[model samples]
Target: MSWSVDNTADRQVECDSVAKQVRSWNWIVGGQYRLVDMMGKGSFANVYSAVNITDEADLVAVKISHEGCEDTLVAEAKVYEKLFGLKGVPRARIYVKERRCGALVMDLLGPSLGNLKDYCGHFSLKTVFMLADQMISRLASLHSRGYIHGDLKEDNFILGRQETIDERTVYLVDFGLAKTFLLTNGEHIAPKTGLNPCGTLRYTSLNCTLGNEISRRDDLESLGYLLIYLHRGDLPWILAESVVGGDEKRRLMADIKLHTPVKKLCEGLPDEFFAYITYCRSLRFDEQPDYARLRLLCEVAMRRLDYEIDGIFDWTIRLRDDLEWKRLLALEDVF
Candidate 1:
């Protein structure tokens, strides 16, 4: 059957229906963590705020797979195990399968880039560059571990809690779709076509939209699109969402992404932005990306703008102002 807009709508409704059908339980997991309020929900799992039973002060995020979807959570746990101890990667505490459902406990993180962007309208150039450097580094780390984050979107990258040493750090999460790009013998996997698209339509790479096998380059390309969207508040192909047929919308977006000149997409931004996208598009399926060079482009942009590469992001400033506003409100109340 030809894909239509109804297909996408039906999928969303199905997810919501599934979420509503899944009963929430305050059950204890691993005899240490107790599930509390749900933090988020996805197609296959629900994430809840859990507390360590023995240490009430210890908080974590528990991701519990829906019944019959245990393998998805199990696969994600394996990816986290491979990524353990890597900077910008969350640490997994435990993984358990009980009653046909898998649960994974990990560090609780702050709001996602998507939420922050919504709060601030659009990020400043300085903030974008700051994020670009760190985000590129995070992807490089994942790639070095022989894995590619098949899904790269603003929601997958989150910040650390406020006032902490890692507050400014951008951590990549949600490895449910992660896969190795290398074979067991350390050889690069051969590229293939006719695969299903693996990421969010809005932020997926052109190659991904074409149904090509996802690789490190696809991840980087998706990141480029994400960075641009964060700064510009939208992309040209965003309008494609309103198109009627799902297949037609996808093709339209692919054409827009393919034909849109980097100069036009990076309009009003520094030349480095263009360079970043161009370089990502130029990489071969098996070739290793120049991680250092991509990072250097961001650094160079910072220098050109005379902006200090100090980690104080737009959200940091917003947080400070919010705190001060609350303090003044308290003072007014006392008066």
Candidate 2:
């Protein structure tokens, strides 16, 4: 409850348990397009690089279905179709047109945030704040249409370089588990049910992990965790010990499932940034982050990094290219 790091034994148990659970699910490996190479693999699905037969020169990323998750995949495909090419979110180029394999195709964006994280250990406070602003803006757009990005994590966020110039920009993707907020005429139409409490445990918020409620605030909470992780390179709590044994892993998962709140894993950060994270975490079901407030926070963070990281600092506009990306990664490589 106090948000201290976990001991080694606890972490081992948690890891082992997660591994066992993953063994039971069915993972599919093919797609309608010619699968070239695996992009990434998660607990439930696998993303692959493929080439479309209809247009051989064009490339696509196909997400295939797995066992115990066909319905969720279908629902996600529908959401993508409805929200395709909408600003702020990745456009799904193709939905599950061939339902038999349950594959959805989308623009083959470059490496994900996970790849960037591997290249750049943890980001500076300024970079994280900027990313938070972008994520919040995207969330605002989604909430306006009554949808919730149930899964928001590093793997789901994509970063790509422009063709003419290597400018790295962020793009949110992976909606296979996204949820639709059941509403009608701006009022609740019915209570939605049957969706799993899915999402990486560390980044998920207290309300979402427990209450089964989805809202724009839920996305904000996740964004807070994303910022914290980007700055800290660790989850709020220590789990190294839990990864050792199966029983301990289950206990950890159960603790998470029961909504046993973890402390702000972002200790020792600057007060202003930490306060922003706390604000994001505390948002209620109906609450949302204020864009103007977020912009101010970004400005404050940019000022704080005016010395050591000043070379990469540009608070006036959003980051839309790979110069910043290369600089950030270079810092990580050397540091």
Candidate 3:
């Protein structure tokens, strides 16, 4: 999970195939990362793995964008800066290299769940349990702080570095579509009636697709889809082909989400899956979800599957030996 290396002239980008989209942003190239290697691109931004010059064993990830996309990165940087001291989120200290181009730097994260899924198919039950617990806890933290991660999908949840205490941790990245669903005074934002689409299509909530303003419930609902996707590797409503227009496709997705029985979607999964969907669906537009209950539900599933709640996960399974990390530190010594 840790990406520090000496003479990183070619430290290599992980998940190159799945995260191949990259563009050259010509600002802040000499600072931050000693070697700015492209990690991958998301729906709207490019990521890079750069060596922190002070320490080869310690590297930082820089996310940059240019032109019209600059504002989204600016907004994302603001969210990271504003949420300082917020655990489970990424590094609170975000540095801006070129404010005009939205070039920014923060602590590097491990592989995204999206890249992992594409490489290894569905996550194991143990991975899902660990991810589900962390995700719900983080979602609760974000909501408690008065923000909705308008975009909640596997790609946004990246693993923490192996060398850090957050090794078992999964940090939720990309606050591009984040919004203050609740006002400063604890009052909800004014309700709207229309389809103002937001976030990724696969995991967006029905309310957001219908043009309604997203709220806490919308985020939790999206989390529901994320959990299912992690469990099954695909959602039931994901169409086989784009036979219809974008609007129509979303309509069918939303309809199938509504019409399809929760039991069917969660056929081979545990009871927690159904509970999550049912609870998310039943939430009033302005209500708070029971974060503890949802996480506890996943805990039950973990027990049913005979997985150790605190066991190391998919990525860290190889680093269990002391020699692995020792070898990494040795590389630092030689450098």
Alpha-carbon local distance difference test for all models: 0.86, 0.61, 0.73
lDDT of 3 by residue, 1-335 (tens): 01122222222232232133333343343464553577765544567787767768767787766434677777888887767677778783455645334566778887788877876677787888788888989889888878888888888888887566766677887888787876778788877876546787678777776667788888888888887888687887777225345666667766877677989988887777888888888888888889999899888888888888875766555445556889999999999
Best by TM-score: 1
Residue-by-residue lDDT tens digits, candidate 1, 1-335 = 12342444454564454345344544788888988777887767788888899999888999888766788889999999999999999899999977567889999888889889988889999999999999999999999999999888888999997667888899999999899999999999999987667778788888988778989999999999999989887998999979877778878988998888889998988999889989988999999999999999999999999999989899888889999999999999999
lDDT of 2 by residue, 163-206 (tens): 42323456778776676665556654343343335566566665
TM-score of each: 0.93, 0.71, 0.82
Which scores greater on TM-score, model 1 or model 2? 1
Q: How would the candidate models be sorted by TM-score, starting from the highest? A: 1, 3, 2
Worst 10 residues of 1 by lDDT: 1-10
> Whose lDDT is higher: candidate 1's or candidate 3's?
1
Q: What are the clashing pairs of model 3?
A: 194-211, 195-210, 195-211, 196-211
**Number of backbone-clashing residue pairs for each candidate, in the order shown:** 0, 28, 4
Q: What stretches of model 2 exceed 4 Å from their correct place?
A: 1-32, 54-56, 97-99, 161-167, 188-196, 240-264, 307-335
Winner by lDDT: 1
lDDT of 1 at 38: 73
Q: Global CA lDDT of candidate 3, please?
A: 0.73
